[model samples]
Target: MKYYKLGIVALSSSLVLGGIAPIAYAETSIPTNVLAAKTTTSEVMDKERLIERVHELFPGMFEDVREEEFRFDSGRSYGEESELESYGLRFFKELSSDMYVSGRFSFVGENLELVYYSYNNENNEEALFPPQVSKEDAEKIAVSFLNRMTNGSDYQLADNDDELYFYDNQTLTEPVEYNFRFDKVVNDVPVPDQSIRIEVLGSGVVSYYFNELTGKQEVFEKKESLLTESEALDRLKEASNVELQYQIQYERSDDVKAVLTYLPSPKIDGIHGMTGQYYIAGELLDKLPKKEKLKVLSSTPVEKTASITKKEAKEMAEQLLMPKNDFVKLNIEGVNERENYRGQRVYDVEFMYETRNGGSGSSIEIDVDTGELIDYRGGFDERFLGEEDSSRPLAYKNALNKAVDYVEKYASSYVHEVAYPNESDNRQNRYDSDDEEYRFYFPRVKDGTIVNGNGIRVSIAGDGELLGFSIDFDQISDWPSLSEVVSKEEALKDYKDVLQTELQYVSNNNQNEYQANHYKLIYTGEMDKEVLRKYYDAQTGEWTAASSRYDSGKQPSDVTIEHPWAEEELNFMIQAGIIEVENPETFNPDAVITKGDALKVLSKSLSRYYRYERYDYEEQKRQTFKNIDTDHDLYGMIELAIDRGVLEADTENFPLDETITREELAVWYGRILKLTNVADHYEIYKLNMKDSEQVEKANVGYVALVGALEIMTPNEDGYYLPDEEVTLAQLALSNMRLAQEMAEMDIDYR
Candidate 1:
């Protein structure tokens, strides 16, 4: 089995295993209470002092340490003094054993703090698989470590919705790591923006920690002066508004359902606890404007076909992104045709510019069918220009007009389906004095209701220049009718049923500034019980979580919780997002497994490309089987299996729904192991089973190979059961073993 190395090191310098660099610490002395003190002035520490501070944090971990100089600047010329020079100090050390540790220190106020640290060891062979420590135990370790830090008592553990045992490129051999985030609290209310994250390995070891709490002192609104919870809830109700939207819901089947749901308007985010006012775009408001009416860009829909050539698309991109200045030279790097998520074929044009100092580049996309510009983002750096503009920035209204004009000129063909957003729909603080750019979204309207997730986003710079533009239009043929939907008032009542609030100290300050100017006491919607946040079905007038609609097929069945045989493997597959069952609540482990379903699980285990896409199969180009066309739900997985050589496409049609046999599964595993040639020569293999004669002549080698590899085993009677129907539980255990064997052999199907 392959073990994954897990560690995080924050440094620009490379790591080299060697002895410690001798440094004299007698010249510079740091205060013992420096780390715990909250000083006002900035303090610069020497190399020796920084090393001493690191040792204090993780005592005896960095005995053989080496110091390295790490410097950085904000687009400034070389040889200039920068703030990073005083704060960013890196150190590395290799222990006498196979363990290695590295850490960095930064000056937070006048105190030196360890900003980042990583500990890794080569002898991870004994690391327990599936994690020995549970999430509950890991949380205890994280909280204990946090409480040991200065002012850590002021923080509370925040809710984490991430999977408990999953990691990127995770294998069964790697130990599990649990990550937690703790938010700082003021007056018993959480400051959502201020948080410290900690990651604990399954071995009860704190592998990583990050403290985002700034050194700058913050002032918060007095909690005593805040309005009561009931008053705040009433204010929220008055400010809240609900709208009808048609959402495309992708299920485990091929058919896509259009869900008409009552979704809350994105206008009101929170209610000020002290003033009983609505907070929109970080600004309090007495009332919100009326919802905007649909304003279609054109009366007729544009022609949708792949009519534009690569040369034509490149020319269009050059016309839009290439600046009309002679000071810089722009070159077209390449152009490629690709299908987008929405099943729209488009041309991606890549280009770059050369300036005297340096160069930057960006790409744009154009719909191949309509020959209309779909996306573009362009901005020239001011430093590369000749002189700075003396004129003032464009007003919000003027910048918006510029964006509208550009969209009308470039993407006019496809604009008929989208409607301009309401003035109140601009979720940003447009009235703010420091606001720079204006972002606008034109949502797709159908049957006089917005299609919540489909829209076009356009961004306009403060100087009235087109900064970015992108169009997202799904090929939706059927839209649910709104005639039988519940009344808006009834839907609003249903929304209020599950609506809950929590007090939080919110900050509207710029993120670049470490210190917040001030924090406001606000009551924000907190639906802690519901995973879907806030969504009400218009037809049923019932609240629903996103899992009910999208993840019903992926959720583990209750019956698999304590099964005698396949519970652990089935649960692992579900947690890893490898297998999908039709009815998760009542998944029958003993049911005969379908050929297509078994192939999907095998492909997902071996191939990285076997991913579930809502609209991916609609645009799939390969059809490995006559029955499994682009319209089939598992078309992509079948094609991926064919590509990986696990499934042969020699047959005209695949029996997707047919019951798979044990011997058939063995053949697929043989192909996955790249032993198909040896399996074909059945005479060269010997079968040591009591029912060896029952196995087919052509499948004897495959059955023998799997039994030898221990991916599959015979019964206690020494019968291979080659002709038996493969059950869900049997397949789950075999797939797990197959994955482990593939990892051991270093076979990467990806």
Candidate 2:
């Protein structure tokens, strides 16, 4: 989140209350057509004429303040309603430059009121006081109050994080409108740049926002808000229990009003509670030439949209307002909130539902503005079972019980909600990084509300643990499941097809003849004992597998496996760092290495060792392979190797699928290395005059390779037998060494 390449901009709501008043017009001057007769070019006269024109359009509608018969001189107002006609207002007088004196005024038939918006900063937002502290004392006391009383004792900078600074104190002028936003740098160093503030909450968070560049508004999502299911609930609970507080720290000019629209509102139900008041904002402008929020506001009722039956539009908005999960149902009744998108008023929707999953079904959450899919739980429960079993979604009680017990022991206080019989699928065979394994979701206990945010995921249906869990430590959740991106069935199909072409193979994870779905998606490299050992030793993730012995488990999915390749170069790459060799003990040999992965290895190899004076042509290199191109990032680097004659290709093309071996690579390297060498490394070798009978007579080139590197030798079988195909791991290890020798920088542009 340092640079937040995955910028989540959002749109939010603003309170523009009520029906439009008729615009007033006056006619004291002649029309523009009549004015055309004037020959005078007086600047002062022009200004007068413009004023007249404006008055003719919206006369008496003062530009100074906008409210129905109400003046906005001080830029502040406070009051809220629980229902219609239940209105109240709070007015304030300047108590000091830093504070204002305000009174809670309500019209409950005559001056009846409640003391709210009293003296207190965020974290104390809900701090209510007795009637004694009049609007005067509240505003006066607030101005003199120190922030140390409110912020945490060990307050650390959310901005410029390494620097230990916290909210020592801050004062908010009435809600003000700012034209732009500012940004912070590498260490969260504050930098004044163009950014629109939908609403600023406290010092470090914005309620809603839109990237000026992309025009996408992502609401309620604060910077780095992602967290584990556990962390998410924990935050929500705390927020609900107490009134939240925040401040705006950036510098703004006197002409600009600093209105912070974002304040996380915490609500509570009888025993359980959910406490996250997020925001939805409008879209931003193009190309951030200035630091500011979007200027356009929509009040128009769409003509086309209006043409649709109001019922249909209402239904669209209702569904959009809720998360799309089949397990939960929703009943929405829209209220006249404030303003709408086209020409209608945005509805204040009231809803309720039941979680069919039988657990504490949380809210049917949806995106604030454009209701889009986020997360869901209810109605349905799933777990791994035999592929051909007649029964499905079976209720496995014992396993669910154990998992909850395990979680409660290590993480009861922060635990959100535990899913029973979570579903899992492996999709690495199609989209590697998008591989999702488990469907288990956990919640964070916040203010008693078990809200889902972030957590660890494991597949209990089998012995395997897809991953131990962790989450970003904030209100947001991480993108744990890639089920949507890579099609699981498709990836497995690809895996089956590749391995089927190989000689007779055995699918080892499950008992004899297990099906493909039972494989439980895994990284191709996870099979290596060294890598697996390291994975567990480092405690990098949770340690569970479908079967510990790999020979006794039972499942019904169809899967075909082939033995690992024997190529030394490939094996070296795996060891050195260029590629992964196995997902488990099995290696599906016939599987075609992806064009993306192939270039990744080669580019990674070159990237480690050398920095070219210039990057080779990006466009041209992609043209080197018939099956690949420069449009792909690998294009330039691959072409660079080819043009330098450092790569070997058949006549006109580089066959991307063929496996490479050590001897072949070494032989190839011998020629390239000699271009700068004073004497040929091949000089020490004599054709057919074998040093060891195991050396193939047909491999004089390999003999020369062995002499040049001097790393390997004849083994117990007495063979340097050079023609064997290389494994991905071997290729990785060699490339890693090459990279180390080159000593390239590891910083990434992204």
Candidate 3:
């Protein structure tokens, strides 16, 4: 699998969950060679230890040196004839009497310029060390200078002992620029050629780059012998303000001519954070309006600047096509940040981004100040994208191809395969991390329940990334890492008569219906699914299943099987009193049903006026029905059902007059019994060979009953056997089920 790290800061971290990119960091440590020879890893940790050392070595010092490294000259000096010099180079060489070379022992920094007070203070700039100061005296001078400069601010010092150490004992800091003011007492011939000889002591390490093309200074930042140049540059670049590069070209004359451009430093700037700066030649100014030249120089930062990858741009465009969110802003095009550009450590970067959803080319940004990329999320304007099919960008096409390949190869299989929307959501953002992530939800996706679905529920995660998602699944349905979901005890409560019934394996003769990434699982048990479906309906909401050859728009029928014992063993039938009670109207028939009472007909069994025993009954006016009375045959049954909230009192209750439909029985049995682990023993509706309507209505109940008993197979179109009377033979099996149930349930009724 290809791995991607998201976001600028995220590039430094490992992906955690759902591709959430954490923060990123630039360089944290200097190279080992930049520290003292004896410094250990312990000394180079978080600059805290360095602080303590600073306090001990230079108590009451002003500004603490936060970073220090030793720069060892790997090569030896040649030409010195002194026997002790070991053929070292001569200290003094003369081109003219005016030129003199003198060796002085000091830190690597002398004509050094390192930052102290971060703010711009023209008067506060000072040299890091004196040219001719000795190692010991240099430390004293450094402490004295920084102490005055920092004024006791809370600053951490740097520690570099081993990696940067040289045989010469001295610590090098960064470079600083200062003018030498000390003059010796000896007076010689007055000459303007008096020069300063500075020694880069300690490791004598310094770094500056010269342009290879022109041999001119592109930009030079020199460090003291004690500095780890790369490390120092990293720390400064982390600030949000770092840009790419800057260039200046002009004639010898002050106002001659020129073209200058500046770009944000790529190292510090992330992709899409590019900033650009440019200047016109003075020669052009002479021929053009003064205002024009000034305007060129004062071009404000672009407004809504965006630098998105191709994929992000496309996604944004797609989002626009569908309009998922009313105000979706995906790819950032261009915008200017000015007036008060607080130092928010900006990084200009360059990367390949693809825009989607509905947005222009991409949400790519080009910064004004640094001439570097600001940000680029993916988006394509509908009008722009649809101008012509072939007008689409090659980059976008490639990205789309990759996405399609991913889905085809990894997505779950189903006849109605998921495909990318031709159009995108069109959000506005720049730089969509490193990967093109998305989620395709399927409102109704089915996976067979391998085990008894006792209190079985489903859920979805990776909302915008995972495929085949749904809303009906319980939250935390398959919690992988945490105990935030239902506890094991709570989950176990739902498993009643459920068992480890051999985990019997069955093979399907048909080919796998799903894709390689998807599986079409089917579960089989002694019980039928019809009873479970009916039970679910009654348990939650009161819904009806009309034998419906076809109701909602759907395709032709699928499968069928037979069920027999639903009339008695079905949980709803027991709740409805279809099963004969053993004691005092309690249906104990070898099957365990707690008892003390229950002799009333349920409200569902009748359609007539019925008595509601409640102190506040008179105040509540209910609807009307038929065929029920206080002296009715099922009076106790109805009363018991009402008391348990299983039946609602109405104007008329249909007591004993109405024959129950199989679906109704299943729904009620599952509902009132609260049977979570109902054994799969019912049947599903199926069409006969000829799909006969008369046969469908005549034996529909038997068909449904079989399904309710988990004995029949279900097809796409429900069970069809109608008009068939339920048999006593079928009723006898319900009792056997009751016996098994009685053995497991511990709850007792009065």
Against the true structure, what is every candidate's RMSD?
Answer: 8.8, 30.9, 38.1
Which tens-of-lDDT digit does each residue in 28-52 have in candidate 1? 1122212322222213345566556
Residues 1-750 of candidate 2 have per-residue lDDT tens digits of 111211221010001101112222221222111121222222312323323332342245224322232211111121122111112232333333332222221111112111111211212121211122333343333222212122222211121111211111111111111112223122222211212122222221222222111111111212243233344333333323221111111111111111111111222111111222211111111221121221111222122212223344346445433534555555554422332211223333344543554432233222233322122222212221112323333243543444454444333333333222222111100112112222333433222222222233323322222222222113222222212222323332322222211011111222121122111111011122212211111111222222111121111212333335434334333433334444635654344344345556655444432111123353122366776553444455566566655564564755565765545554543333322132132344443333344444444544443333332333456455565455455444444333321221111111
TM values, all candidates: 0.79, 0.25, 0.15
lDDT order of candidates, best first?
1, 2, 3
Count of clashing residue pairs in every prediction:
1, 103, 221
TM-score result, candidate 3: 0.15
Q: Cα deviation in Å at residue 498, candidate 2? A: 39
lDDT of 3 by residue, 160-223 (tens): 1112111111111122222111111112211111111122222221111110011111121121
Q: Sorted by TM-score, highest first, which candidate order results?
A: 1, 2, 3
Question: Which of the predicted structures, 1 or 2, would earn the higher lDDT when compared with the native?
Answer: 1
lDDT values of the candidates?
0.65, 0.29, 0.25
Q: Candidate 2 at residue 119, lDDT? A: 19
**lDDT-best of 2 and 3:** 2
In model 1, what are the clashing residue pairs, if there are any? 305-369
